[model samples]
Target: MQYRKFGKTGETVSALGFGCMRLPILNEKSENIDVKRAEEMLNYAYEHGVTYFDTAYVYHRPMHQGISKGFSENVLGNCFQGAKREKIFYATKLPTFVIQSPDEFEKTLHESLTSLKTDRIDFYLAHSLTKQTWDRMIQMGMLEFLQKAKESGKVRHLGFSFHDELPVFKEIVDSFDWEFAQIQYNYLDIRVQAGTEGLHYAASKNLGMVIMEPLRGGKLAVTPTEEVRNIWKKSQYDRSMAQRGLLFVWDDPAVSVVLSGMSTLDQVKENVRSADSAIAGTLSDFERSLYAEARKAYWNRTVVPCTGCEYCLPCPAGVNIPSNLNIVNELAMFGDVTLSKGNYEFQPPSERSENCVQCGVCLTKCPQHIQIPDHLQKLTEQMK
Candidate 1:
């Protein structure tokens, strides 16, 4: 229910925006979105003052399929039916990453509009901009396309969502006069791609910063290891782990809106309460130390500390090299070998760690010089 000024736009957005990536599903199947439940949750969030709803072109798939499938946006539109659309700002992305030509940009935009059943998008962003995509956008005259959209009143605010290295992030930020930008930020990813640095840099330009993956794709909010739980207890704050994690992000003044992809009413309520009490400068020195200790505990247990510099990419054997390492790290850190093993085994053979052919293609590219093939073999054995 708390609000913050969305950069210099003078629009006050709820600190906790509703992210529609993980709407309630039927029988735990992501593809079968429980539309009735989703509608109820959306209405509940709206009734409780969550005015910002974020969806994307690639959410709810298999059963629903496609970006404009209407499973997500349609449910939201139904919930807000007969209500003032202007009071609730709708945000979606143009999948420019998948565009092969300049004309495709307009096609994607019109598709998104039709999907959401809205003519004007309150906030529109270039989805998942890598360095390559940014350059391609320029080469294909994407700016001209955006200007045209703005002139037509289709997109009110222009921005981008990022997933590249810090240097490239700076390049993209400096490339255009963006109204806002979205980045993946959380306690565990402070130094990762477009971490706190990108957030601060964008804010420095007076551009509103929208945060995604605030829970690291729901990792931080789940149950923690004994060490992490002890650290949370020591913090002496009467809040759950999810609240603590959210408070950390919202406490930073640079953060304009912290998005949570909640699927259940309980999650919506918990996050809304966290947002209500999340004030900057509320964490004392001791509380901050507790958070640092918790982070160390998490790092010591779950992840291999890979910086994801993509030096270990392009595995010759088709192994999802970084993703496998991350899974191993999560299992080790959380002391949940069963969950980790299940996750690893459920993946397709091409993505499994055992698929590593020891080709050493990932090693030379690795900035950390990690023995990737060897470590992958070890992880595969351990999981087995």
Candidate 2:
């Protein structure tokens, strides 16, 4: 496997990190992991040179069914034993949602360490930080907790995984002395949460950057639509859609590692092959253009033509026009209606499409001439 320098640490880690969130499962149950199959996949990946193993306290739990967490850490702990355990870089997170106070920090740390069968964690993160959770963490003395954890030799390095707007991302990065960060990034999500600008800013601070959701949660890895496939055909290099997606993230020199949550042995083998050939700054100008073209092709498939411009904002009915429509566009682009529907639930009740009064005020301001109220009505029905 190819290796890259991990930012200020100057330590060389495998270009590809193994994310333990999506191991194979049985009976359509998230908590009922298929251990034998998962063990084989993990063993193959480790033998092929993937050393960074990332898990979390809440990984492999049934979110809807209310199952207890830590199955992922237990499974991983069972897979590697003897000398293998010390060689691997164990990375896991302190669940942000469960952190109600400063006291919960150490309690949770010991829980994860016990689950992993490890005394010290190699890389620990504040998991899934948003603006609200971040503020709560600070107010509860996160900095002091981290310092104590490090000084006690329980956690070797500190980092965070983000899922918020760029401004909040920048605030979190600047607020702490972080050793690394993980963010959602892909060719299609160039301007999404912690996009290109966030990547460079963290690198500027000498923080090692780990890329999560490099395939946009497996959307970019699937068979492309006809329009996107035609665009990929023009490229001189022959690669699967998934490999192309991964290489796009690995192409950046600033990235320390790209995490892939492999569920099958075939995926482990294929990703290992891709990582072996991953090099920074190798994409030709023309090849890079294909990514941009592919992105546009996906956008073209969206039902709404909203450019996310706020010109139609300040809705008379208090509806958030751009935000609601963007969720529909995300469904079209990624072909994941269930995920898109879940995304809609996060919107404020006052800003939801249900609040649109079918007023014609936004029609005059919209440059695309989209039927604003008509789409809002459709969205309300579809999401329901």
Candidate 3:
């Protein structure tokens, strides 16, 4: 695997880090992970030089009674049992939304340390930080919590995973002396949350930039439209959409690592192979043009402007706004809506857009300023 110097840390992390949120699950419901199988996949990644592993406070979440969720960290503890723990860097996050008080900072950190069966976290992040959460954290004395974690020697590096507007991201980056940061970046998200501008700004500040959602939750890896496929097929390089996605992110010298939430062993292998060729500044002018053309093909077909940032979440009416919009986008992309309809139905009854109450609260929160309720009403009609 190719390695890059993690900015200001003097540590060279593998080009591909393992995002542990989407492990192979025990059932179609995706609540419980198949631990033994996941461990084998993770073990393969570790042996193959994926030195970074990331999880979160709410990943692999359990919703039902006795569903046995929160396996992300526990499974990592098991996967890195014994001397394996020293072989890689373990990264996890603080659940910023649920922190009622400043004291919960240490409380949650202690819980995470215990769950991972480790004394110190190699990298600890303020999970899913938005402007609202950052402001609340300031009021709750979060700076002290950050300082204490470092001074107490419990966390080696401090950073955040971001999901807000570019201005907000800039504010947070300037607010603290962070060692690294993770953001959603892909070919399709060049102008989305945080976008290319934010990526360059963070890199200019010398904070190690770790990329998440390189595949847009596996959407970019799927078969492209015939037009987009022809563009790739006509290109000199025989690269898959997924490879193009990974390569585009890695082409930027700002990107320190690209994290893929690999669910299957095949995904791990494919990503690892991609990592081998992921040299910074390697894409030629023609290749860069191909990515631009490919993105145009998607934009030509895309209906909604949503980037799935999920900032307008926990809808008072219980609608899954971002995901529902993604399904709706499939219609414009593929010229069919069956995938959208199926995906919309697959969402829990409470999370489906059909439950929208047209309250307009999401209007104030959405970065794109979407008329969310109005769109949901139209989508509900289309689905029906």
Give the top-scoring candidate (lDDT). 2
Better of 1 and 2 by lDDT: 2
Candidate 3: lDDT over CA atoms? 0.86
lDDT of 3 at 253: 95
Off by over 4 Å in 2: 65-68, 304-327, 334-384
Cα lDDT computed for each candidate against the true fold: 0.81, 0.89, 0.86
Worst 10 residues of 3 by lDDT: 62-71
Cα lDDT of model 2 by residue, 1-384, tens digit:
999988775667899999999999998667789999999999998999998999999898865543356599999888887799978899999888877778889999998999898889989999999999998888898888988999899999999999989999999999878999999999998898899999999999999999999988777887777788899999998899889999999999989999998889999999999998889999999999999999998977889988777899899889989999988777778676667676677576788899988878999999999898898898899888
The alpha-carbon deviation from the true structure for residue 356 of candidate 3, after best TM-score superposition, in angstroms, is 4.8
- Which digits, one per residue and each the tens of the lDDT, describe model 3 over residues 1-384? 999999876788999999998899876645578988899899999999899999976677775433232668888987796789988998899888878887888888887888888998988999889889999998998877987898898988999999988999999999999989999999888988799999999999999999999988777888877898888876798887788889999999999999999989998988999999989999999888988998889878877889787899979998889988877776677554665675677677788888998998999999998888888998899989
- C-alpha positional error of residue 74 in candidate 1 after TM-score superposition, expressed in Å: 3.1
Off-target runs (Cα >4 Å) in candidate 1 are 27-29, 63-70, 302-305, 311-313, 336-349, 357-369, 381-384
Q: Give lDDT tens digits, candidate 1, residues 115-155.
A: 77788888888889998888888899988888789889998
Screening candidate 1 with a backbone cut-off below 3 angstroms (N, C-alpha, C), the clashing residue pairs are 57-67, 301-333, 302-329, 302-333, 311-365
Clashing pairs in 3: none
